[model samples]
Target chain A: MLVIRRDLVDAMVAHARRDHPDEACGQIAGPEGSDRPERIIEMENAERSPTFYRFDAAEQLKVYREMQANDEEAVVIYHSHTATEAYPSRTDIKFANEPQAHYVLVSTRDPIEHELRSYRIVDGVVTEEPVKIIES
Target chain B: MAVTVSIPTILRTHTGGEKSVSATGTTLAEIIDDLENNHGGLKARLVKEGALHRFVNVYVNDEDVRFAGGLTAPVKDGDNVTILPAVAGG
Candidate 1:
């Protein structure tokens, strides 16, 4: 299960809503070996395509460096789907390099509502996990 | 000194079912060469036409190397190198 702050979930939902037709992507980092997600880092989708999302290569490099400097690791990697349900695509499973990270998907198919879910994509396998929202 | 390269599940056949393998090099290019020498067929899968395959994403210590220097990105001992395919689908 992935435990996240309610505010962070709201921020992600807002970001997904703001990027309506286009998909949004971002991540949360936490201290290494600690599954607690504490940092919300919004990322620019290089593709900007409604059906696809790729982190800007340069920006991704910088964020990784920052996480390393802070002795942290990406605990949750998230992206939004404008037209699909909150689930990992075959592609998402293939690109899931961080086996320890929770892959979160938010669907903004509805203008005013969103569907959020989390999963573990490890070794090309996908396992849905429960999300427990907490108060910060 | 060796750098640990994490192999995606689909490509583990090239590494003989190993999830990760240690190779020696000062740069990513050299590391690929080393991996190719040790694990045949991996280089062809990772690179095409003298460049990293467009569908592939390589990260050193979780940092994608394309922005750092691509194939020439410097690497050192004890670094973690990750190679994954670009995600697709909605």
Candidate 2:
């Protein structure tokens, strides 16, 4: 299960909505060994395509170094599927190298309603998990 | 030409759970070769058909090697070689 804050969930949804028609990707960082996501680090979608998303290499390095200096790790890696369901695609599973992260998928296919789901993708296997939002 | 190579968590199995390891080489290719000497299965993960795998991002002191020259990028003593699996999807 992934326990996240309400504001964080809202922020992710907003980002997804802002980048509709193109994929949006980012990560949430928390103290090392802490699954609690306390900070959101939005990343540029280098590909900038609706079907693909990649973190810009230089920007990724910068954020990674910052996390290291602050003793934090990415607790959640998230992206939006503008026209698809909130589930990991074959491409998402293929490129998921972070075994310890919660892969959050937000689907904004419907303008009035959004679907959000979380999964654990490890070794080419994806298992959906429950998400509990804590009001803040 | 000693350099520090930082390993991402996913590849730690190749380095016996080591987060960072030292290898000696004047170029990125040579460094990978030296690393393979001690960590047997790593080269296969980072290199494919004699080039850096598209799935991995390698940097020498903050400069991404893809722009520098791929596997032939130069490295010097005390440089940091960081390998990160590209966070990407299609």
TM-score of every model?
A: 0.75, 0.99
Give DockQ for candidates 1 onward, in order. 0.33, 0.89
- What DockQ score does model 2 reach against the true complex? 0.89
lDDT of 2 at A77: 98
Choose the strongest candidate by TM-score.
2
Q: In model 1 chain A, which range of ten residues has the least summed lDDT? A: A56-65
- lDDT by residue for model 1 (A17-103), tens: 998899999999999899999989999898989988888766776776688689888898899989989989877877776677899
User: Per-residue alpha-carbon lDDT of model 2 for B16-54, expressed as tens digits?
Assistant: 999999999999999999999999999999999999999
Q: After superposition, how far is residue A8 of candidate 1 from its true place, in Å?
A: 0.9
Scored against the true structure, residue B84 in model 2 reaches a CA lDDT of 93
Q: After TM-score superposition, what is the CA distance of residue B46 in candidate 1 from its true location, in Å?
A: 2.4
TM-score of chain A of each: 0.97, 0.99
Q: Give residue B15's lDDT in candidate 2 (0 to 100).
A: 93
The list of candidate 2 runs beyond 4 A from truth reads none
